[model samples]
Each structure stands twice: as structure tokens, then as C-alpha cells.
Target: MRLPPLKALPVFEAVARTLSFSAAAEELHVTQSAVSHQIRQLEDDLGESLFERGGRRVALTEQGERYLEAIAPALAQIERASEQLRGVTDSRIRLAVPSSFAVSWLIPRLPHLQRQHPELDLDLEMLADMPLMSERLADCFITFRYRQRGYSSERLYVERLFAVCSRQYWNRVRDELDEAGLRKRGSGVTIRPEWLTRFTLLSAASVFERPGEDWRRWFAAGEAKLPADAHVQHFSHMLLAHEAARHHQGIALSNDYMLDTASDPDLIKLPTHELQTGDEFHFACKTARRNEPGIRHLSQWLVKQAEASGWKV
Candidate 1:
């Protein structure tokens, strides 16, 4: 037996299951008129009225009910088969993450996760900012300072802010300042708090300017005062600032979560300052999706990694 246009089946199923053209359209991300058009086309092809339309609502007709029963299982089987062929189960996770977090944290750990759960597939959407929970853009979101009422959330890490510079930049500054009449203590050279103003400050314009997470706050926390007029280069994102610091363009205020102090020999954290912003990283998703196998597994893995790294949960 040949199939009537396969595209219309999903439209029909959505409309039949919901019994509302508008609801089906919303679920299918189309207009109600488009749903009606597809249904009309399907009905013409089958030579039957699939729905009984009332004043405002709709109900599946007897033929429609039978058609739904027959096709729903077939569609489900096709979906399952497609997933299987793609080497995944019904548990694929669509995760939305901040671009900086994805690059600094999640991407590094992805290889280990893939090794552990080869059957799972993760689709990552990187956004500059956290999306509203109501948008439902992805199955889960990993972000900083995100809180929503209807969704379930788990803390991943608390952020500690500090200044970071390339080792080459630090050495160049130290030598320059020492030659320029700055005192050197014994074998080790000391950089004064005010000396930070000498270098071009790379600021995360968006991230730090969010209320309490600013250069002023960091300076206060470190007991260092900024000069009235300090030369600063601003970037909209922390990732960009980090890159600038890495390339020796300037010193960047960095969060502990992104900087690997032990392994990264090129970047060095400047002494005498750390700011605890009370804000934390979190993994969140709709409560309904909390129990899905892929979500559960990924959430657990994230929590484990956080704990292993000694980050606050």
C-alpha cells in the first residue's frame, strides 16, 4: 500500500490529538491557516472529512479516529527507527548553554561524557545570554544567575572573580616597572595594586556590568583602587576578553570556572584579589523533562564533575 503524503500525517496527528487547529499549529510551529490547508489537502486525498467542526472547537470524526489509531503507531515506529539509525535512543538532549561556558567548561568534558555514554547524543545551542524559560528553545539550559519559577534547576558552580594576564605580559610589565624605578623585593618582584592601571584593562562589558559584578566591585574586593582615568578595552563577552588576555592584549578580569590555573601555564592569576559575586552557574530545564533518561544522565554527570572539581553544588 502506498502512503498519502507523509507530511500531512504529522499535521493530521497533531490536530487529531489536540482537537484544535490553533493548538496543533502552535505545537507544529506553523500558522492555524497552514494546519487547515494541510488538513484540507489530506481530506481531499482521502475523500473523507476527518473532523467535525463546531462553533469554536473541533472533534475527530469516526473516520478520523480510526485513521489516527492506525497512523500514530506507524509514525512512532518511524521515529524510533530513525533514532536508532542515528545511533541514539528516544533520549536525545537539546541543551542551550552560554557560549563562554560551552567553550571553557562543557566542551572540555564532552569527550569523557561521549566515552561513557556513547549511545547518547547531545545537541548544544550556544547563546550569548540566557534565554527565557518560557521560550522552550532547548530541552535544558546551562547558564549563570538563571532562575525561573516553573522549571527545575540545579547549581553547578559558584563563580569567583579574579584578574588574569598572560605570563609574557606579566613578565614584560614587571621588567618595565622595575626599570622605571619600581622596587624589587629580594629575588621576587612585587607588583603594586596601583600598577594594574598601567596596563590596558580588558573588561567583560556585559557580564561584569550586571549590577554587582563590575571592575569597581573587584577592585574593592581586592583592596585595590582604580585610578580616576584608567585605559580599558571593553568586549561584550567574557570569552572575547579571555582571548584578549591570552594574546597579551591586556589584563582580563576572569572567573575561576573558566580559567584552569593548574594546567594553563601561559595564563597567570594576579595576586591579592578574589570576588565572590553570590551568583552561580546552574543547569535548568522544564520540570516535565527532568525525568527523561538523557536529561537525568547529563544532569548527574554535570553535578559529579562540579563536585570533583570542588565547586559548590
Candidate 2:
């Protein structure tokens, strides 16, 4: 036996669930007459009345209830199956991101998208190059850049660095260093007199350059100087540097997104006072592929998820 046209199922489902053609019309954003027409067509296809009209209200008949019970689960399953197939068959997106952002911002927020759309497959790649529209290897790229160079370069987030140290570092000398004693060290966090004499200051690699931004600026503001013979470490990626700090190796200058993104609870900020960097993290994709269905969906969903999760970068 031939079944009803598949397209009218949504119109019929909405009306049946709501028990009112007007309500379904409002939800579907269609005219009441349009909803009535589809339901009538569906009834004719099934050779029965699906709804009993009682004045303005509509109630499903026995057959209508059975049809809903049978069709609802099938329709829902079809929708999910379609997405799964889309995830596999549709275009796959390749993302190249800076190591810092991949770890501290985008990586943490990825689960939201995966949970919301399980069928969507994502491939993430990390790099340090500035994101640009003309990149050859990436469908999309996220990187920290100074300014927008073209239409595809849109600012996703702007962040600045703060002084952060390990939890061990904080607890080790919390009792000995009162607020005043700590202030004497100038920019550093307060430490006990004994701890101050021994604990060395941490410094970043000289090559890790951000214009007008560094621990030095922070030190100058507080009239402090790095302790002599303090240990210095070099890392090619900011994430690696931050990880070192999290391990209690040393304190480091870091950004809010970096701090928020770290999985290790060992790292903590020294205080609210922070150094500001005008540099911004940007999102860039090829102009042609920007509107493609998979990329578009991911772009919109990612932005919303990131904003809701509180990591602006």
C-alpha cells in the first residue's frame, strides 16, 4: 500500500503534538490554512480522519494516536541517522590553530560541539603561524594576530597576560608572607622572608616577543626587578611554557584564556593586577568555503559555544 507524502509528516506531527492547528501553525511559522491542508491530505492518504474537531480545539483520533506513536520514533531516528551520515559523507573540516589556543580555549570547549552534534567529525591541527585567508593547508585557522588584514580576518577574542604560579608555590609560603612583606618584592607575589631570600624569580624566553608586553612591564609598574640568578626557560609554544608554570617549575606571564583553558588546577593567579596586550586572537577561513554547510554550521556553533563557556578567545 502506498503511504502519505513524507514531507507532510512534520506539519502533521507538530499539529498532533500541540493538539491545535493554530499552535502548530505558529510553531511552523505557516498559515493555519496550510496546516489544515496538509493534515487533510494526510488523512486522505491514510483513508481516515486523524483529528476530531471539537469547536476550536483538535484532538487526535485513536488511529492518529497510533500513527504518532509509530511515526515519531521513526522520524527522530531518521533525523539522527541523517546527521551521522552527514558527519561521515559530508566535507570534513581541518582546523589549524596555535598551540596555546588549541590547548587553553578551543580544546576545552570542543566537547560541547561533539556532544551536541555527535555526527560531526572534526580534525584539529596545531601551528604557530598567523591565521590568514590565503593559507594553503587549512580549511580554517585560529591564531593570535595583531590586526585584520582582509575580509576573512575577523577578531574572535583579544586577551592579555597575568602573572600566574603553581598552587604549590602559593601554599608553600602563604603564612610567612603578609601582604606588606610581599609588596616589598615589588611585582612578585608576597612570600615569607625566608622564602624570598631563596626562591628564584621565573623568566620567559627573550624570543617570545609581544610588543610593549612582558613580565618586565609588570615589574616596572610595581618598581620591582627580577631576582639575580633566577632560572630562565625557553619554549617554542606558549602552551608548553604555561605547562611548565603549572608544574611548579616557575611562575609565568599568561593570558586569561590560557589560565581558564588549563586542565591542571595546580596553576593559580598571583593577584588581579595584570599586564595588557593589545594583540588579538582571530578566526580566518577561505572566503569561498566560509558559507559551505558544514563549515558554516561549525563556525556558528563554535562561536556560540565558546561565548557561552566564558572563554572570549
Number of the top candidate by lDDT?
1
> What would the TM-scores of all predictions be?
0.68, 0.57
lDDT of 2 at 299: 75
Give the residue spans of candidate 1 off by over 4 A: 1-88, 177-183, 186-192, 210-213
Location of the lowest summed lDDT over 10 successive residues in candidate 1: 129-138
Candidate 1 lDDT at 76 equals: 56
Give the whole-model CA lDDT for all candidates, comma-separated: 0.78, 0.65
Worst ten in a row by lDDT for model 2? 191-200
lDDT of each residue in 41-86, candidate 2, tens digit only: 8888889888999999788898987777667656655654686777
- What does the lDDT come to for candidate 1? 0.78
Q: Give the TM-score of candidate 1.
A: 0.68
